[model samples]
Target: MLDKIYVIDTNVLLQDPKAIYSFQHNEVIIPAVVLEEVDSKKRYMDEVGRNARHVSKLIDSMRGKGKLHEGVALENGGMLRVELNHRSFQYLQDKFVEKTNDNRIIAVALNLLLEEQTKENGRQVILVSKDALVRVKADALGIPAEDFLSDRVVEFNQIYTGYQERFVSSEVLTGFYKNNGIPIETLQCGILYPNQYVILKDTLRKSVSAVGKVDRSRSFLKKCAFDNEHVWGITARNVQQRMALDLLLRRDISLVTMVGKAGTGKTLLAMAAGLMQTEDLNNYKKLLIARPIVPVGKDIGYLPGEKDEKLKPWMQPIYDNLEYLFNVKKSAELDKILAGISSIQVEALTYIRGRSLPEQYIVIDEAQNLTKHEVKTILTRVGEGSKIVMLGDPKQIDHPYLDEYNNGLTYVVEKFKDQQVSGHVKLEKGERSQLAQLAADIL
Candidate 1:
């Protein structure tokens, strides 16, 4: 087999700076235009800027070993090279006359393909990109293209839901309830993770069932702690939500993740649990609600006012849920009430990077827009006595570099399933409204 050449796009590096080493033993080529684009974005104050600077330093360090135009040896037995030639867009002039950065990058791959075709046993050149249009344009120019998939931890359909259904005999089902908890060996099931929810059903009667969660030891199936109780003013409408509430209310579990679609009550229930713990139970000293400021469409740009006013647009959803929970009718009234209650605080995720949050109930909304590194930074900020809940719909990610399978929400759910200190729940039902549920399903 021939070692293929992978031409990476600027977005790929911006999404993950280590993508250059992810090609295994294959040759990796970065178009010169990618460096120029990366330099342009290095001044921003976000993950993209950090990645741009990191990748720039990596490539600059390679200069000591050899000229980038030629090649440099990688630790993974791969080769990294910056393609400086092929700036001419004459080949694609008739097809793509805009002379955009994408076209220039495609030109590099096209020229490499033509050059490699002359060899007796030629290496195939593949254009690797995160942008769909860039891949489409490469295909139009007769070059192979693919999306960078090394960062994706799991397939979308096969992602862990933290729950499963099991059919047991009537005697076992009765014993589970009779004993308050049953040994996991009685289920005779496959491997189960810690804190995983199990719905036990009677084989004779499908309607007769009971829900239990695997204990931290993974040796027993125990009943949920908050199965029928109400948190603040909210109640679980389904089995999954019940499991989520149990995890959220547990002071032992430091990290909780909730994945669901719009109108699924992920954020609302999380807020209720946070409020109940911070205000009602006094388990935590404060409730901090925040979300990423990723705009669904074009950003409205700068706003005039203080930090609170600047954050109102981004944190509106959190405020909406707070209003529903407090039963306030007007924004001014809500603000006044929130000010009186010193336990509740709402802010943007941007300000959370540098602070140590101890003895706080932190709720991160729209967490799917965050990258894995950003999530890691946030999780590390949790001090000695803090519980953080990350809530988001992986399928509804708004971040350009992320998708359903590779976002931070999905990453945490998959990576922390076995640990006793963490728990996860995937809410399927939309409890917001019938119309909202219909829209979520069809749209």
Candidate 2:
């Protein structure tokens, strides 16, 4: 078998600095233009900047092993090279601008393809890029391109939904309702994760059913404790919502992830549960609500105002849910009420990087916008007695580098599905309104 060569793109490294080591035993080519792009972004104070700096440090560290232009040995037994002589644009000059960074990167791959074809037994040279247009252009030039799949936890369709339906005997179903627990093996379901919910149905009677969750022991499927309970004047509108509430209210579970489409009540349910635990039950000291500031389309740039005033626009969705929970009609009145209580705090995820939160109910809304590293950093900040709920619709991600299967929310759901400290629920029904549901379905 011939070894393959993968040409790395700038956006791929910016999305994950460790991408250099992902292609095991394969020749990895980093076009010189990608380094130029990485250098331009290294001075900023964001995730991209950090990743850019990391990439530079990685390449620089390899200098001791060998010259990068000649090729250096990677830790994974792969060869890493910085292509310097492939700047020719003879193939793309007719179709694309010569000076653009993307075209320059594509030119390197095209030149490599031409060089490989001249050999008697040439290895396959493939372009790996996260950008669809780059891959499309590479295909037009007859170079194979693929998305970076190393960070993908699971395919979008195969992602864990936190629950599954199981068929059981009528006697088993009756025992589950009467005794509030049933042995997991009774249903012959194989290897259920701890905290995973199950819908039990009678074989003879389709309508007769019961909902239960796998206990921490993974030995029995126990009935949900808070399915019928109310939280901050809110009740679960569906089965998934009830499971979400149960997870949110559990003190044993440290992390809760809820994913759904728009109008599915992901944020509202999380906020309601946080408010109930923090205020009504007195289980936590404060309710910290936050979300990333990723916009749908073009950014409006910076706004001029105080921090809270500036955040009003980005944090309006959170405030809207709070207003509904508090039954407040005016924003000013809501501010006064929040200030008076002092326990409910609305914060931005930007400022949460360096702080340690203890005895707090932290709800991270729009978590789908966060990357895997960002989510890991946030989770590490959870001090003792803190419960963090990550809520987002994976399908509604606004982050350029994220998608339904690779975002932080989806990452956490898949990675922690089998852990006893975590619980997850994917809400299916939209509870917002008839019109809103229709829009989410059709649009």
Candidate 3:
């Protein structure tokens, strides 16, 4: 039985160009208007444009298999077809105009629905779109509509937090603190991933507590190497922060992801760690910091200056952190200090593509604004002996098409949590100030 027919929108294809074969053993339709929109975006240079071009190539390849106006057999045993000549304006119940792309797509679905009524057991025609407005309009017209789920993390809150609290007997706590390294498998807390942090608390003695991270190589729980170490006069305020610091300082871990809300010290801590590893320890050749040019509010328009000078405003937050770390008070002093330090480089993410970076400590701040493809592109730029840290608050995404579930930072944390070379920590407490913490909580 042909149980379902998926009418995919242009946004869905742009989001994931290989969506043509995702519906296993079901029929997939690309509305006529969607091709027009995809063709218009093929000449662009961004990720969306790249995906549009890829979709066009994919459709073109399928044309040799069979007529696209009829259908072609997908490798996944599904039928793929390009919808044409069913964009009737009179099919819509609403007063939707004809020239609009969204309305034309809806008309194609309406025609499909009407044709299905003549069959005894018609397949359910579901409109799959990434645009929420299109889904809402389809629902008003009694067509089933849903979001494309190829990259979405269902129930994103359930993702790994990277920290766990376990209550233990005072004897176990004593053993952990006395030996400084206990077999984590003996704790009987089930399986633990590499670099996962655990907090031990005494049930009888409420004040007694200890913190350790999982050492998978030795099958033990060991104390953090830099637990008491300070990075640029900054120390870890909590256990999660302590875990983050450990991950940052470790040479074996190449990728680290930190997620938290505002005032959680995510940015400040990452920058501090980057400076320590780059300037003090000489572990890396340089400290390269970049972020997507996402506007927090209204964009201030383009600034008139050289590339470095124009990047000053976009990277001012990083400069602010540097000044705080170096105990500088003014931008002039900070600029003077930065000019003297040849190891520090601040640039926008736009210029980072197709470049090789080796022996560097890279921090991509506000990384949640990046798409998964953008993240992959940035990561592929890393040369040998480089560590990349992604820092962001999933809840504060600024990209119009991204959210907590599908953004680059969240994607990295979820996809790499199981790797031995990757470490993640989701900081919860805000250390900016009491007032800022309260605002983050109640606001």
Candidate 4:
């Protein structure tokens, strides 16, 4: 097979700095304009800045062996080149302005496509980008373009739902109920993942059913802790919510991921469980609740106030859920309730970077707005005896650079599917209200 050449855009590098190494046995190109663009974003205060600095370090380390302008050899037998002189304004003069980095990148890809075509060197040149507009422009200009697909973990249909349904013989169902547990080998199904929830139905009579969790290490099908567990006056409204409650209330499962749509009780139930573990049960030292501060649309400027006052608007939804949990009627009373309980701490993910939370119930709400790296950092901050719960609606993400498949919550769910210490639940029903559920379905 002929080798291919891929010209990567700046956004691709920023989305994942190690993306250049993903294309196996293929030549990689980085336009000079992309480096300039990456340099400008290194001053950012978020993950983008961290990625920019990482890309810089990667390129700097490559410079020790050879000049980047004259291609360097990667360890995987691929060539890496920095295209320096492709910022010409000759291509797409009428359709696009040459002042932008996107245009410059397109120009680089166009020139390289022409050069490779003229030489007929048994290679195809394709432009790789994460921006839809850039790919559209490339298609219009007759240059081949594709999305960078390294970070996408799974398709929506292929994503693990953390629960499975299997039909078992009536005898097995009876045995499970009589013994309160069953040996996994007797089920006659394929091997199941650790911590995966399963619904066992009687083949003859589907009405006789049971829900259990697969503990592959112990080789047993233990009944889930759903029937008797209640969190902060909230009971499971459905089977999915019941499974989520089982994962949330378990001390053995250190990390939990919950993905659902609007009004699915993802955030509310997580906060309730955190409260139960921290306040009522005294299982943890504090209930630390936070969420990423991503705006829905164009951000207005910063609000003027102190820390708590500034966070009031961004964190109002969390406070609203707290009010529902505390049954407080007013803001002053909520303040008094919060003040009276030193076991709860309400904050934002912005200030959680450099702290080690020990014996705490950390609830990360709206976690779909976070990138994979940011989520990793947050999970690693979990100290001994701490439980971390991340819950989000993948369909309601506000982060511009993330999507349903590549968001951190989904990524963690997919990655930790088989691990013994991790558990995930996808709440399907919206239990908030009839109106909210209908609105989510149509609009």
Query: Counting only residues 3 or more apart in sequence or on different chains, how many pairs clash (N, Cα, C under 3 Å) in candidate 4?
Result: 0
Off by over 4 Å in 1: 225-228
Question: What lDDT does the true structure give each of the candidates?
Answer: 0.91, 0.91, 0.87, 0.88
Off by over 4 Å in 4: 216-218
Give per-residue lDDT, candidate 4, residue 218: 44
Give residue 126's lDDT in candidate 2 (0 to 100).
Answer: 97
Which tens-of-lDDT digit does each residue in 263-371 have in candidate 1?
9999999999999898888999999998989999898999999998998988888889999999999989999999899989898888877899999999999999999
Comparison by lDDT, 1 against 3, better one = 1
Which prediction has more favorable lDDT, 2 or 4?
2
List the candidate numbers ranked by TM-score, top first: 2, 1, 4, 3
- Better model by TM-score, 1 or 4? 1
Clashes of each: 0, 0, 0, 0
Q: Write the per-residue lDDT of candidate 3 for residues 271-380, one digit (tens) a residue.
A: 89999999889999999999989898788998998998888889989888888998988989988988899999998999987799999999999999998889999999
Worst 10 residues of 2 by lDDT: 223-232
